[model samples]
Target chain A: MSDAAAGPLATVTLRVDAAEIDAFAETLGMPASPVPPTFPIRFLFHPEIRAALAMFLPADGSLPIHVGQRFRYHRPLTAGETLTCAVSATPPGGARPFALVRLDVSDGTGAAVCQAESEIAIAAPGFTWDKLK
Target chain B: MNPPRPGEKLAAVPIGPLDGAAIERYARASGDDNPVHLDPAAAGAIGLPDRIAHGMLVMGRLSRLALGWRSDAVLEAFECRFTRPVPAGAALTGDGRVAKVDALADGHRVILRLLARDADGAIAAMGEATLRLPG
Candidate 1:
């Protein structure tokens, strides 16, 4: 995808790997479920996507900080399905000076796999601002 | 807070001490290599005392609690915000409780309150989740 006027937009496709799913559960010390609810995050914000995010950072050298996240699912994504993710990074909102990165993951068949919204702090290192507790 | 019941405490998630190695493992596992979660120098440059665990890493603990609920229940939604920076290497505790339950067209909608705290007792992350259970 080309760069949008507002920010950078990138897309990538990946297959749902069962090993990856079980690893996520094992890492968290939980028994893997028949379906993973939040596994899409790994692929949606995978390393390359993170690089895409860095490109949109403020020219002042401020790095992005993840402040919050929300996940919605039509149904749990299972194995045997390939996913395509469209990630768009938007400049910080007016009231809050934080970037809102939206990621929409869909099955190859165009079905919604999961929708995730990430709130990132776009402040550069050493920048001063009221910190939230 | 008068008394607690056995059936009430559904899950006890043991968030192992989040250290650099562990954080790196999580970064590798979650595919989130945000420098802040892996580099203490970078985290310090940003005013954080040290490298901090990803908010999702802390939030994921709630899944254990969600799963401990009725087997028929399906986790429909989960939402939360980062309240404070949970420095890597701190022992974290996760607790979940049923806040409310309502009837839905397909099943019962169960709302569960989720909270994770550092060893110091400060809330690291908190949120609510909805589960649809066929009755």
Candidate 2:
């Protein structure tokens, strides 16, 4: 993962692996052809993106709870296609201490493929915005 | 197929009694190896009663139910809010209703309000989807 310019926190290249899609399809008991609408969310959990998210997590063992998700597909993603994914996150805030993470995926030709956003609730006592960089 | 009228209910899809192995498969497939969804011990340490299913996995099943409503329609957007965590061994059923429909030059744009209910009929998650049906 490399540092991205102003908007995105980091960027990484992702391939739409057929095997992974098959596994996902089997798990959901769906056909693998059209690529499930929520399939692109897997991109958000890429190791690189996880590493980037680690910074916002509290030192405590408290796990972040996934509270919300949204996906907008510009076109159906196909297996074996390589794409670029850029991820960005908001600082943990609000009375509940939550963060919004956004992911933008683009095809090899720089065309938009999909965009996903997830909301995670961080449950750390006494946590404040000042604690984050 | 005829366009569905507002307030029409779509067929419900029943999902698992999501056992550990099923959650593990989804963990591997999605690369979301978060211990909270995999290891019971890890989940316990974090104050959870047991390992929970991945929220995305639940959303995937709900999206499948919505997609099945119209074969010719393409899902343009989907948004879900995980109101409750689905513990291991929980069974869920996805349901949706046509919220609105708009006629475009080519086809109709449909909006669907969705929900995932636990075995007891408690809401685990709620969502909305927009699909484009070509003429």
Q: Root-mean-square deviation of each candidate, in angstroms?
A: 4.0, 4.3
lDDT of 2 by residue, A67-91 (tens): 8899998999999999999998876
Best by DockQ: 1
User: Candidate 1 residues B1-135, lDDT tens each?
Assistant: 122222355576777677777778778878888788888888888788888888887777666677666777777788777788888888888887878867767666778887888888788788777777775
Query: Which CAPRI tier for candidate 2?
Result: acceptable
For model 1, the stretches where C-alpha displacement exceeds 4 angstroms are A1-8, A59-61, A127-130, B1-9
Q: What tens digits encode model 1's per-residue C-alpha lDDT throughout A5-122?
A: 5654788887888888887877677666665565677875576786776677656645566677888877888776788888987676557566678888888789897888887776
lDDT of 2: 0.84
Whole-model Cα lDDT of every candidate shown, in order: 0.73, 0.84
lDDT tens readout by residue for model 2, B9-99: 9899987868898899999898888778988887777566888998888998888878899888889999998887789999999999999
TM-score quality measure for candidate 1: 0.87
